[model samples]
Target: MRKYSRKKKEIAVEDYVSGIKSGDRTMLARAITLVESHTNRHFTVAQQVIEQLGSVKTNSIRIGITGVPGAGKSTFIDSFGTYLCELGYRVAVLAVDPSSEVSKGSILGDKTRMERLSNNPRAFIRPSPSSGTLGGVNRKTRETIFLCEAAGFDIILIETVGVGQGEFVVRSMVDFFLLLVLTGAGDELQTMKKGIMELPDLVVVNKADGDNVSKAKQAMREYNTILHFLRPYTEGWTTKAVTASALEETGLIEIYKEIEQFIHMTRNNGIFEKRRTEQLKEWFDSSLKDKLYAQFFYDEKMKESLLQYEKLIIDGEKTVGNSVNELISLFLNKKE
Candidate 1:
């Protein structure tokens, strides 16, 4: 292990903040890469960056976008983000890609899909691997959001891995959640019936160009009917569905307008502050749980005992639940 140097770390953090303030894209990317690193020395450096950036933190609008595979999320973000930048909003996109368990590598092809926005000076694109973490969010994502905010990005967009049960995780971290759907699938209503649609403040029907335009309109009608039966998650705010052609760059302005309206309504109604407080409480709880689990696994005696319990369960000497209970008891009862 390399010896930790406080002074060197401070200098690096200062450079990072300076680059961020001046809108240096390369330095922004390097800062995120450094923060995502797992080594102890890098962790210290990352913390220093966070502390230095804490004072002038960015208060950007955080938007979470999610959908099933093939819903054109990247295309939508690229077009929509570019539109935001054109309107003079600095945008930062954090695209989460699922990790391959076999090789522990990420495809991370979001930048390829978002060609235009990736090259924009006002936009920053980051593709992070899920790394088998729960909630489809990595440990570094929230930190990266902070860094981007500090960098003066007025709009922060988070594109989640559009896999099973991940939208809920994304919802916990963003101010507004948008669910994208493709039209003419006949299953649009069915998709909306799933839990993912329930969480979205706004549902967008993408690919509304070509022959799908009428069908997309019909799908929006169907979604409106379905939404009637579901209770709104945020008080005084009803979830809405709209259509857009991301490929043709149509209807994006209305989408942004709707988002602005939602934010205005929620903030005025005090629901936004309430949701943020709840989110912070959940974050602390989840962090504590992860730390406790790590400590348990790191303890030599507890690790050995866990292995024995696993063997006993496999050999039919104990049931899995009972073994886990005993292990938890042993871990909790241990003295320093």
Candidate 2:
């Protein structure tokens, strides 16, 4: 215990918070590492850091970027993040990579892919493993966002794994959700149309250079039409689709401008605050559900009973619904 105390003291949460407030990138990374740690021993320090972070108050513009596997999301974020840094905005990117279930660890290739951006002093890139969590956004991501904001990043970009369900989870956590699309016509557009079309605050047909420029433009038009039919997420904020060549850095500025316009419109109409309030409510509800589920499954007797119930179901002695009800009764009785 004394050795553990010494190591904890060596990290110094107050020093980390001070460095973060001054926009020190190293300190910011260290803070995130500490928060992401699985050890419960860090909880006290983590809470203290979170408390100090309250003063920072997250004025950052949170953006979620998602697309199918080949849609050039990493490249676009690398280019766009560089643009933001050049314009003097401190940026933090949280890229959620899918973890291999067997290994329970991420490939962590986003940093390698976005080499230049990863090296930027004004930018911090963290690649987090999805850990098979129900939501595309991991449990620790919300906390990490606050840490980034406290560290003075004015722009927070969350890049989700391109899987459709993950995209929706990412959308819920951001102020703006940008969907990257590739050049496609009838079949391809129809395939992507359902999962992503309704959620994106802005859609960009990426890889718009080379021979695909015309096709990309046509796809953008198709997406625009799709957007018209889906009800706008908030009144006075219209979703727009555009084309961009991340390789050539073309149309990136326009995307940023559109985001600014959307933010302005939403804030003026009070929808921005309302959305944030709703997001907080969702976070609270999700936390409650998670706690309840953990308690239900983690109780020693519940685990043993669940195994027994599974055996009974396999042997045809109990119906699945009745078994579940029995488990719930045991769970409730135990609580009582």
Candidate 3:
């Protein structure tokens, strides 16, 4: 009998870059998954692919949509993206779904609900599993944005997991942040809080059709009152409230106009490029911190030292602060 050995297939960086630049959706999807991977080789390949796509000039509209559960996020994206596609725009929707505890995967599966956009040749939708990442988004999402832009998509909509504090993370990466709110859903208190209200460039009262129309209008009024008290979330823009019915595809035009107005205002005032520059700087620092921490903590010798320090803390032999300092010193001094 012969023993069999299998080698992993090598990724060609130029091929991915060329394909993405040529607007090949398959290669774009592959590049996104490659960057999302945690392997060392894939990391190298991801870097190469991004580098080869340096300074892509596509001025795609990057927007982040966040809301509490049941705020009609998927339907909103489907309607908004379909509208954009009808206008001859190539749109990409990146929906971040909450992870399942058992499998650690996206539980809702955004595709099932985005049938209209999925069938549109002008649209591409990718659902990413948050996997309980601290920010409720994948760390590689910034990289994914670049890939989508390089693929010549004119519009990019990022739908966050909408589970606590994740809105802030998504806000940092997009030109406009839209907060979707439900009517008569006790969201007045949700919108009353200063932190959540400060994130949106626009606050939308979703499901504003039919019998809920009055409640949605009332919710819009309430949100407007709240916004009047809070300072503007972004420079050169005021957060406005509007009503929309994603299921009926009504009020989407207003949302689109708001986005266009934001982009125009920011671009004319030079804030658009400035914001993107700041986002890139923040991403670089965050990635550097992650890499350094991984290198220091994952070393075999350092891992053993960390376990020993953890035991000391568990046994109350050393304070957490003191143990952290000692562990840093151990790595700095290259001691096991």
Candidate with maximal TM-score: 3
Tens-digit lDDT string for candidate 1 (134-252): 33144466667777877788999988756654576668778899989887535644654356657888889899999889999998887777778888766788898899999999999
RMSD list, candidates in order = 4.6, 4.3, 4.4
lDDT of each: 0.76, 0.77, 0.80
lDDT of 3: 0.80
Tens-digit lDDT track of model 2 for 1-336: 223555434467678778888878777777777666544445446656777766456668999998877788889888999999999998998866543344465533448788778888888888775354333134457778878888888999988756545677777788888988887745655566365677888889899998888998999998888788987665777888899998999998999899999999888888788888876777667545644765677567888999999999999999999999999988998754
All candidates: TM-score: 0.79, 0.80, 0.83
Residue 28 CA displacement from its true place in model 3, Å = 1.6
Q: What is the per-residue lDDT of model 3 for residues 175-252, given as tens digits with 9 covering 90 to 100?
A: 999998887535445544447878899999999988999989998888888788888988768888999999888888
- Candidate numbers, best lDDT first, in rank order: 3, 2, 1
Better of 1 and 2 by lDDT: 2
Better structure of 1 and 2 per TM-score: 2
Error of 3 at 114 (Å): 0.8
Model 2 RMSD to the real structure?
4.3
Clashes of 2: 0
**True lDDT of residue 236, candidate 1:** 80
Backbone clash count for every predicted candidate, in the order shown: 0, 0, 0
lDDT at 74, model 3? 84
